[model samples]
Target: MKLQKAPQAAPELVHLEALLGKASVTPLDAGCQPYLAERLEELGFIVERLPCQGVDNLIARRPGVPSLAFAGHTDVVPAGQHWQVPPFQLSELGGYLYGRGIADMKGGIAAFLVAVERALATGHELPGLMLLLTSDEEGEAEFGSRVMAQHLKTQGLLPPWVLVGEPTARSHSGDTLRVGRRGAVSGTLRLSGRAGHVAYLPPTANLLHRALALGQQLAALEWDSGAPDFPGTVLHVTGLEHGDWLDNVTPSSATLRFNLRYSHKTSKDAIDQRIRALVPGDLDFQLDWDRPCEPYFSLFGEAQPNFLTRVERAVFKGLGQFPVLSTAGGASDGRFFSALGCEVIELGLPNASIHQANERVEKGEYLRLIDIYQALLESL
Candidate 1:
């Protein structure tokens, strides 16, 4: 079979920008949810909607065998203040597209979709291709991709490979790929305390002071020196709340919530045990945690050779160098897919203004990502 030279840029990428012009806030809403669904159907793929709590997700498949899935989220992080252009509307100033989800993900989805369409038009058939769009990736994601993944598993339709289109580009917005991510464990801690007057504290330690001490101990307790794929296990006192801070009265109760970005080197139970070991024996404290997902390594012997080569070719063609292969940073939905034993890797337009005010992407980089996606499809 003859392979046609890859296009310098996907022309359809711009049309993709227009399609996602309707933006959804957190979970899926009427404005963007239905709009995305219609667009996917128009692309000639069989689509499924797995209703997620309040949000909805889209799963479109071009049927065959041993599938390759391109997964991403459509709902954007709240567009915070810091915009010279409207966050929802597209602006082409300085050759960059400024919008809420432009870089973090909307650009990713557009590029992948255009690649799929281009491959189809050029008679470049894939084993099977799927575009999985969820609305709750930036939210709790309690009911979005997790739900669809479960359904696919039950139906024996989970794809063999997954490419999560999370922007991993550093400095600029191209040439980065993330193949591994650390795990996340989050919960609240509350230590019960007895009320007492500040001036008349007698035989007991003040509840507020005890709680503060416990928090200090928890934070100071070393989690791990550091791990191979993830940074050292560390704890952050994200939220500290007290019912009262009065001068005369001691607090009766206090609560705090913290998160742990951990690695596969340790289990949640082990981390919990470490926390328990750091607390005072007299204080009554509660620890609650849920293992959202464990980290996975996708770079291995045989498969990685082909995948990485294709990825690097596209990266070099678009952004001029192999991006830094670093894993000590933000978590991704790709981490979840990797844990499920699929070959998961993420590469997309540069991540310049992700999860920040007026997230933007270089329009040129967006099209470049499409070329990369198409190249990956051909090489894979």
Candidate 2:
């Protein structure tokens, strides 16, 4: 594919182009972390590499009393079909930079790095600044920031303030900031019933019918009206399956999978109990649950007043617009840090095309994001 070069791009855009050039798909760093580690080391950060079960994690810290931390992922979802340019290569068209991870992340990562570099060049005192990057965040997250957070907790290195570089902006680069995220709980349900000929099996004994009915009941459930910072709890039946392929035979078993994105107004325990209660008494069934994250609000305890104000002020200064505090998104690595008592906020480029074909972000937005991040660091 012929790529159109970015005309006189800034250092951050150049860096982001380099990052997008590497194909670090989910669960694979593809040298992205190593490259970042080298750059960070040159900037006087004490870089630590923590590799867990094939996933790469990096913690780069500047020696000082820790005040702020930046968190992000190096991994991106697979570049699926349909692209005007190579998915792994950075392409410029119509004043936009196209790549797989540019908007979803890598763009944010590059912006932060350049922001740090520029801030340090100006002799800015960013005492106790840290950057946390992981390769497993786009995957199962079994061995990424979750492990890093645990390690930081043990070493008493967890920062009080965390800024996650997730693509949170709705309209422009700094229009919205994610003050919190909704929690997710996913479940796989298996129902067992006696297999029989279609003519002999009654409606009560049909596993498929039972599965569909249960799915409807679960979907129709209304959990809550939600709080001011979050939306209402919603459930989605992701998958349903049965073993039998023959049309005339009733399947002996059926399986249903579902997920719930709930707000802070509800607890995981409450969702779990409510789901269990919905199961019929006579059905032979089993339910397995996976709680990936819990909802968190941006409350800094005793530090709330100064820390949040600084962030908001920096954003406004950089973008010429005050950002709206939002809590409307799926779970992210920020949830882990928030759970560990850090006041977490997510800020980055616009997210309109993330995880979609031909993903791209405006070059201007990318450049401005660097200023916003730099301003944030300087404010600290």
Candidate 3:
């Protein structure tokens, strides 16, 4: 794509450019949160800097019970090699703004800020509003929104509705709004057996052979048929390892690393039980599990018509088309709010280039998002 300078700076673009100037790589706010805090404070918000284990977090709230909260992260993934423009500086090319975190998701943050400013400028009192920002979303995520959610719960400040600015749109801005996310569980399976020469080893003694057989069975196992809003539970064997380097020798042990993206229809305990049943009773094996998160939907029980209807109308008003409600993404911080019994929805710029080299968002789409968010705020 050819590089072209934008004609003029819009408020949201200017904000995004300043944010892109900050090299806030994972676990490092690099002054991004403080800059945002200053702007929010100017809007009559009480900004609190909550740092957890070196990760920067900010919770800015206007007086009153928080009815709507905008949640996002400032930290970005490492800007890898081979970019067409400097990753730390915003560049406009072919009507797209390129920079790290522009789509995942400093762009969303900037748009929301401008939207809030525009909304309040009308001299209309908005419902109780809050902003939750963290600089660790792209890192281990242990100290980001997870910790913020705890603090909110303690202070009794958790909002009834949360809008996470994760890049959920596909083809265009507001095309897809995520109502929920699938849970992710990772596992390591190690099978132990006797090592011997390939020609001399018994079939049962070759752990690699057993591992392959078990892997096939595991891959074929049906977890769940899926729900209307969520996809079916599926397993993917990510890696396989064996100690043997020589072709003639059978390794004594083998390890298989796998991950499962499960829907709410299947429980973690149920998944564990099924995996255990698939293993041969006579085999010596070890199965280890990592921290697993459960799937969550914005509509926990019955659907809340008011909240969903407002969002849909706002999206339609902004884009002239209603968005499709989906729960197909991997995971996001929105789950933190959903866990708190908050109705959470994720909507933002198109995600085609997020986290990739030359990450970018269409300049028009970025401006349009400001309108969408403003409309949503007004409707609420």
Candidate 4:
């Protein structure tokens, strides 16, 4: 079934479609930079560059009172082997549009630029609406919008309300407004033991076994039963290293790398305490509070009902369903925005194939997203 769009919405949408035609695959947003900057400048935005190594970030805005910011990335994960249509070339295959980043979020960058541009063209005061685009998101993200957010905050550049264009859609609902997200805490647990031949019966315990036990405990520990607007926190063990390449030699040490997507309820100190308590001594263990970031909650207790009310009404009218206020997922630049206490929410196209080849979004749904974004701009 096709999603419907009004005739008046066709023109600007064609522009979005054309931009997707230009492939902005990661590290090489190749032809995408000038096009975006030109479009924003054409719309009378004051655009600036946040220079990084090879890729660059963009900050664009139309001046207003209480500032507003929309953030998203231009980088697409490398395309794999799923091409009914060329991943770099945009095409309407079936009812969906096929292309890398169409959903994971070229769709967002396209819609907001057009909606905000249209709104500004209306000549009504918007109390300050802005948009920022970064190219380092799909990579290590060491130099993307997060860095921009920090820079903005230091210079008092943070805005009043911020929306991150992360695809937050599910089967039952068209979109969900992400009010909060669990904070990601990660660490390297190193255990040391005596190096010896496998046949040598040493009194020393196997550091590998100790590290494995520690990993099990850390993996089982619960971070939270979910925060006010988010889901139960999740802990995942990403790396386990031991048995040095020389298998027969009882390697002196083993390492485990793990991460916790913890809710705001559990602070880093508390989480660390629980971890260290589980270790058995003479095990020679090393722990790092490698929490480069902390989990954050929105101004989202019952205390901020009005804020959610405004967003729910907007989501209801915009997408025909009230957004489920949520805080589940990997960390995003939203974490940085939240630090400065911006009323943050993330919404975008259905994440059908965000970081993959032949990535695509339904043409119908893509068009509908513009209407949704337009509705949000109109309401806010």
Candidate 5:
């Protein structure tokens, strides 16, 4: 048999390979931002490193008006063992690029970088462009985008438009763009009762029983019919616990953990009040809520009101079809910038394998992402 040479990787793959090879997990940058800053600096951007609460953030901006911020994260979720290929090494197999954060975001970041390189090479005068890189998106997100956003707001340096490179596509790379996301609230619910023997249960009403009824009520109630731009509110019981297993004794207290992904039509206080009403008047119970990301929506029509029309047309020019404007996913860092009056939109590769073993992104889709981002830049 004749010997054959193996094909070389694409240039875009080369850039992504270097990024994936870095050991950045959760809140750790693992030196990825320095590498990106070098590239941005070469493009006439002034790079600034902002470290907050042990998390690394980079802001690269070119001097000009009408700034557009391109936001992304360098941090990735932990890559657990048991994968067909090394999770941290960029692997090309059957026309797909596999890595830890390829589908979720690193690939999106790489695409934007490639797009900027191409645009700058062509001598296209881009309006004020800012790259907001953070290392805290996959973690608590406390010292990440929010930190930069607040700092920029205080200095009156907040951009008028922001593009978050979060993986939002469902089936195709440009098939869907997230206009907004529902708000999330999570915490524990506690109920108290007296302890007693199972056989003699007069004074001890079972906290578990009352909690079960409350859980059922919350799950069954229909909060809203969902707005045209948002989804209906829903509550989920994540965990339930009581005293240790004792066949002869009744537990004194019970705790139930829950999360609610509510729409813009619903408020946290409203949901809290509604939950309060479900608990029995005689039961001694308390429900604590943790509000993380609030619900937000961007108006989309022709072009003037929101930037959705221009982005949609750009996506069509790149992918040969318009994308659906949706708000059906979990919250993202985009919400932080949106609160500052920036028109924010999320666009990236399909999210089929994010946060899973052997997370992969299609090679064709990866290339298309670059095209979509470049076209968006030109339009802006």
Candidate 6:
């Protein structure tokens, strides 16, 4: 790829470059949120800093009806060893901006801000508009968008629609738009048995042997045939643990940790019941469940045609491209809004370099995203 200097530094890149200079790796704001808050305040937004635990969140709102919220995270994953350019320093290489979070997020945030800036400058009337930013999205995420969502709900300020800049596009900036996400549920299975020497005959116990059989049963059990809008509910045994290995002794207990990414067709209780049924009657066991995100689709079944139609039109007008509406991806903050009865969609730069070494996004795509966001904001 031949590198070319961009015509000039676009306003959005100026902001992104400033953000990329900050060392705000996951769970740390690195003063990025405060910097953004100041800029938003200057744009006539009511900015509020909401800090939960060590994670910083910022909510900036403008008065109007029919609310539209733009959500993004300022955090970037830790940069691994290989990088032609410093991960924290924004550099243009091969007409692409190289930096962590540029593709995964910060670029999206910068674009949205620029969109708002241009819209206001053009004297365009915007409906209730807001930005929800968190530093916890790339980390444990318990205190980030999750906390902000709860707070918004309490204040009766939850937006009717939300746009999350989560790098959903594949081949091009507007090629893919994530309209839904799968839910993730995890469980730990503890199987117990009497401990005894393997060589001794009196009272021998083999928890590993029993566990293997139970695991096979669970693995073979059919969860669900994927629905049209979502993939099948699948489960995988992520880890297996047992006591120290000994030539002549059998471990007394075994533990298996399994996780499942499921759709709305299944429930935690239903999955729990299936596991209980698969357990052998003679074995003593316990199953514990933890659910992080719930499945949601904004344009599935008898869903909102008007809202999605507007979004489609905006994409066409902004990028001269028709985006593919999809639900294929891991969990994101979009789920929180979906749970709050708000329509959520994710759109951003191509994700080929997201979370990878020398992560970068096309400078052209970054500019196009700002235009897309601006058009989407106008349509809303």
lDDT for every model? 0.72, 0.88, 0.88, 0.72, 0.84, 0.84
Candidate 2 residue lDDT tens string, 234-349 = 89999999984898988889999999888778988898788889989999989898865788877756654567777788788888989998888777888888888988989999
Alpha-carbon error at 321 in model 4, in Å? 2.6
Residue-level lDDT for 131 in candidate 5? 95
CA lDDT, candidate 5, residue 42 = 86
Question: For candidate 2, what is the lDDT?
Answer: 0.88
Candidate 5 lDDT, 100-217, residue by residue in tens: 9998789999999998888877877786889999999998899999999998898788988788999999877888988888889996889997877877775337667777877787
Candidate scoring better on TM-score of 4 and 5: 5
lDDT of 3 by residue, 20-76 (tens): 999999989999988999988889999999998999999998888788899999999
Candidate 2 stretches with Cα past 4 Å from truth are: 1-3, 7-10, 193-217, 237-256, 280-282, 302-305
Candidate 4 per-residue lDDT over residues 122-227, each given as its tens digit: 7644556777788877777777777788877786767877878888876322467777777777877787777767677453555666677778887787556874
Displacement of residue 231 (Cα, Å) in model 6 is 0.5
> Candidate order by TM-score, highest to lowest?
6, 3, 5, 2, 4, 1
Clash count, candidate 3: 0
Worst 10 residues of 1 by lDDT: 1-10
**Which candidate do you rate higher for lDDT, 2 or 4?**
2
Give the range of the ten consecutive residues with the poorest summed lDDT in model 2. Answer: 5-14
| Candidate 6 residue lDDT tens string, 24-59 | 998998989999999998988889999999999999
Off by over 4 Å in 1: 1-10, 29-44, 80-86, 171-173, 196-209, 238-257, 289-306, 356-358
- What lDDT tens digits, residue by residue, belong to model 1 across residues 296-359? 5576437555555666776676667776665656667776566567777788777767888867
Predicted structure 3, TM vs. truth:
0.91
Off by over 4 Å in 5: 1-11, 196-209, 244-250, 300-305
TM-score of 4: 0.84
